[model samples]
Target chain A: MENFTPGASFLGGVLIGLSASLLLLCNGKIAGISGILGGLLRPVRDDTLWRVFFIAGLLAGGAILRLVSPQVFDIALTRSGEVFLLAGLLVGFGARLGSGCTSGHGVCGISRLSPRSLLATLIFMTAGIVTVYIVNTFFGGAL
Target chain B: MSTLVTSFLAGMLFAVGLGLSGMTQPAKVVGFLDLTGRWDPSLACVMLGAIAVHAPAYRLIRRRSAPIFAAAFAIPTRRDFDLRLVGGAALFGIGWGLGGFCPGPAITSLPSGHTAVLLFVPAMVAGMYLHTLVEGLQVRRSGIVHPETVSRSPTLPPSPALQYRHDA
Candidate 1:
């Protein structure tokens, strides 16, 4: 409702799709953010540079956003630092263990009609929904 | 050089998309996920828009014999469903719900220099490194050399079985 932004969301999504398409067509790589970043943890010959540059670009892009549209960087969550730490660990470990995250499996994999990606997406989305519900109901809706 | 440049540009474009779509805002992401409590469907729109463009583009680009800048497409071809996939995704979901930040948005939000991003990113990296350590130990314990290491070592002839696994 009050915060809905279909137009901007759609346009942004198109740009994402375009970015993925560019990576795929040009580099013959899946534009999976987790995969790219994780690959850097243990470097591979020739593979290391692209991942680094891509990540650098992400950071630079973020800096640009901070300059152009600071509103996008707003933080509204009241979650504790401990919660963030836990969440980060789970996200990092889970994304690697599962072999993909939202971008890899959700956007790119699902678009390719991969059955595994489809199932993974469903599982994660369900898990997220359930987690949110539990936190909202049981944790006094602090998050 | 071209590949690196392309990657940098693509990453930038992807970040822009995430930002423009309101993905960088944890509140917006959480709002979308809050289905039972004042649901916001804008995130759904983002997905739809991304898929609508990428699906057809993927099919088209794949029709080419090889990519413009690379020898072959490095798409994942795994078909079998397994516990690791299910379990990992579930864990990731829980974290995502708790934090409202997935890998991409989290990285893109780094310039904000927020405590959440700073705390989250390093911990996430540690988690990733931990996975590497555990996997290495598992490989060691099982007495099976990691395929990457095996391939890298010129002395060891690449096992046909390992090659098949890589292709698949």
Candidate 2:
């Protein structure tokens, strides 16, 4: 609520969409973060370099943003390190198992009107909402 | 070279969008996911904006025979709502709610040098690699033929067994 900026969010969404389109149009790839990063964990030789560069580009994005508008990034977390690790593990496993996440399933897949992505987006969001509710209402805001 | 450049640019652009959209901030993401509380609807705009541009662009792009760099479009074309898809997404939602960081924003925010991301990314990677390794073993255990392990590169390869869903 304190930092909500609808206009910027919408603009950023367009940027994200443009990026996804760029990948599909040019390299025939989805701009899914988990999929892209997941590929690196396995490290296929021919497919590795492009992923590395893409990740490098991601790092560069943060760097550029920091240099230009540091306030745009507020990477704060209320959760403990152990919880983050657990969450990260689940995210990794789930995304791999599920095959996509917010960007991939929620944005790109759904845009194509893929029923699978729609189901994914709905399920994940519902799960997320429920989890947040549990954490806030029971666990004192973080688990 | 074109592949590298385009991929890199796309990655950068995506990260920038995530940052600007407030997706990099765990609190903001949590706000969006927390529907009952002081729910923030900014992420809705982000999703709408992304789909508005991407869906149409995707439909248009499919008209092309092949991408400029790749031999053929390397997109997923599977259509199924199998248990794995539902179960995996359910798990991911728990993680997203718990940590407020999906893989993209989590990685994208690393350069900010936050402690949470520092801890989270490595663990996420470990989980990802571990899942594939375990699943790979399970496939072999079930007497299924070895799945295609070398058709793609080190970055996210297609999940042949567990996930056949098209690239979202």
Candidate 3:
């Protein structure tokens, strides 16, 4: 509860919604980060440029945040490198196989009321909940 | 040029949103996921805020015939409830809960020069390729030329009938 900033989180959420909406409105694209990055992994001809630009924007955004408010970026990753690596793999596979992540399924997809997105969001969130439980309670937060 | 600008701006906005929402912090994300622990409801607020804005926006945008930069709405149209969607999501959730970094925040944090993100992003990419390989292998074993038969290429300009690309 100590880290909970409801107002800021809500504001940030609004911004995320605005970004996704704008992407859909202007570019006719869904702002799924994994899909955007995944597509780049395969390197399609017509799609690569836009993704690169978008990714660059993301990098720049992060860099700018780092420069301006370094405190905001003070993300505490308590997990081990191995844990991060394993989680990364699962995320990559699951996002591709599931066809979206928090953005695509949780935000954009849910907004559209897509059944698949709803299901994906539910499953992932549940999985996240369960994993956190196991890691913290059973594994003693070492995983 | 417009597409590039919009895409870049969208990316920036999204990253800023993530940062502001405390999504860039693994502890915050884990806090939300840790329902049994000291649960921080910030991530839920973020989702609620995003959905509140996006759902209405989606309705308004759908009323239009075409987007300004593209010919039509690039939305996924698949209706089937298959294993890929559920299984993939379940696996992704485990990863997210374990890592506290989804694709967007992870990608956004790459330039921060953090040891965790540097290792995680590459491993995530490797995991993506690994899935593709496994999928290809599965298709080959089944002796089918048609892979992802029910789904369209997620990378192309999204068609109405295209399967959704569930990237977060």
Candidate 4:
């Protein structure tokens, strides 16, 4: 439809960063989705409820937001369902491999002045930049 | 469970922000990353929002004796930049430029079912694991001291579960 504004992206980043920092500050945990989801893959008996609740909350949040801000919602899935599923798997694996996801490292890690996080965040951002170029240029929209 | 609960709430909020900000779309993210060209300044706003909201929250949280989990705070303090750091950055740059998704936003948007992110995210994760494995092997092979391996101070001790909390 209309071109999205930079204001929204900035606000969104702020919200994401705030949410992540608040969680870490209060809960002493990194809000890395990969780690949380990975934990679900092979969860301990004591942990099942929390993880389930956490993921459920995530879904509820989206649905609620959609209802609250229909104009802002603008919901759209950019890729096929099959592709999305595959991406989810890779991200899950990457989060574990990296020891944390972007939220964990990019937000919380960097905020805390963790050297590993700074490096991780840098890498993560760089990867994101490169992926966009390749996709838009050589890969075509098929990617 | 506690950690999961907290993280879940955080993720939900994150998802809300992503949706509201139009970050769930690859075109949007890629647009923001196109600094040298069209130079979308929208992503900067996100960074500002995060920074503005987080400054105070961080102050309060850092004052705590320990986190709400079991043992301690997990803040890392490695200051030195090394090859691992540089190489990882390069790889991450390549992926992001190619795929239009990084680990954080990519994971947040998964529920929406974006196809390209589906591909980019896994590759991102694989890269992460690959980094870890390679790092381990490197450590074993050369014994070249990685500056990051050393811990300066013992991390804050973990505290017992506390009451529900939220700060923005």
Candidate 4: clashing residue pairs, number: 37
**Segments of candidate 4 deviating more than 4 angstroms:** A1-4, A42-49, A69-94, A139-142, B1-8, B68-71, B77-95, B103-168
**lDDT score at residue B89, model 3, on the 0-100 scale:** 97
Predictions in order: lDDT = 0.86, 0.85, 0.86, 0.55
Of all true interface contacts, what fraction is found in model 4?
0.42
* lDDT of candidate 2 over A1-143, digit per residue (tens): 66568999999999999999998899888888888888776665577788888898988898888888777667555788899999999999999889889988999889888788899999999999999999999987866
The two-chain DockQ for each candidate, comma-separated, is: 0.74, 0.79, 0.77, 0.33
RMSD for each of the candidates: 2.6, 3.5, 3.6, 7.2
Q: How well does candidate 4 reproduce the true complex, by DockQ?
A: 0.33
* Share of reference contacts kept by candidate 3: 0.87
Predicted structure with the largest DockQ when compared to the true one: 2
Q: Give TM-scores of the second chain, every candidate.
A: 0.88, 0.88, 0.84, 0.74
Candidate 3 residue A107 Cα shift, in angstroms, is: 0.2
Task: Give the alpha carbon lDDT tens digit for every residue of B43-136 in model 2.
Answer: 9999998998999999999999988888777676777678988998999999999999998888888888888989889988988898779877
Q: Each model's TM-score, in the order given?
A: 0.94, 0.93, 0.91, 0.67
The residue pairs in collision within model 1 are none
Q: What would the per-residue lDDT of candidate 1 be over residues B86-116, giving only the tens digit for each residue?
A: 9989998999889989999999999999999
For residues A1-143, could you state the per-residue lDDT of candidate 1 as single tens digits?
Answer: 99999999999999999999999999988888988998888776777898898898888899999999988989798798988899899999888888888888889999999887888889988898888888888997675
| Cand. 4 TM to true fold | 0.67
